[model samples]
Target: MMAFSSVTEPLRAANRVGGKEPYSWHLISADGEPVSSSSGFALLPDFAITSSPELSHVFVVASIGVRPDRNAPRAIRVEASSRSIPHRPR
Candidate 1:
């Protein structure tokens, strides 16, 4: 999972309910470091997208922005799929 900053709880819940154990779910960041969410949560990625092996799926979990806010970056969406990776966001 590309795991953009939010939706970690829901993803974990879905995996638990669906019984789909990730062979290896890795957290990734643009800088190979930690990212903070709008909701005050912080995530420490396991690797940087540029360095990780190609994945079957990359999920970008971003919350709906405030009225004056903008959407998640286009690059994040593009990067998720550029390497033949399927993207899912929730």
Candidate 2:
């Protein structure tokens, strides 16, 4: 939740400052269902990845439950996008 909020709040603040909705985002899940955060809060996604639109940017944040090792879901942690998104392991 912290990671997601950290990325989004800035865009929200930008909209508030500009007095218009200059940035828009959609919540997406692999299955198009509600995903649970580390705090157990549920977020309903707008689209499933297979059905997603042409996005200008895609942020695939692995949940706290995921392991960053080789066993992690290949589709989730896309290698190409990972170059832009930093990885912090615990």
lDDT of each: 0.61, 0.71
The lDDT of model 2 is: 0.71
Where is model 2 more than 4 Å wrong at Cα? 63-90
TM-score of model 2 relative to the true fold?
Answer: 0.69
Per model, state how many residue pairs clash: 0, 0
**Residue-level lDDT tens digits of model 1 in 1-90:** 223423466667777888996544687776577766667677788887667777766664555552322333544556666776555567
lDDT of 2 by residue, 56-85 (tens): 777667656754544224534564254444
**Of the candidates shown, which would achieve the greatest lDDT relative to the real structure?**
2
Which prediction has the highest TM-score against the true structure? 2
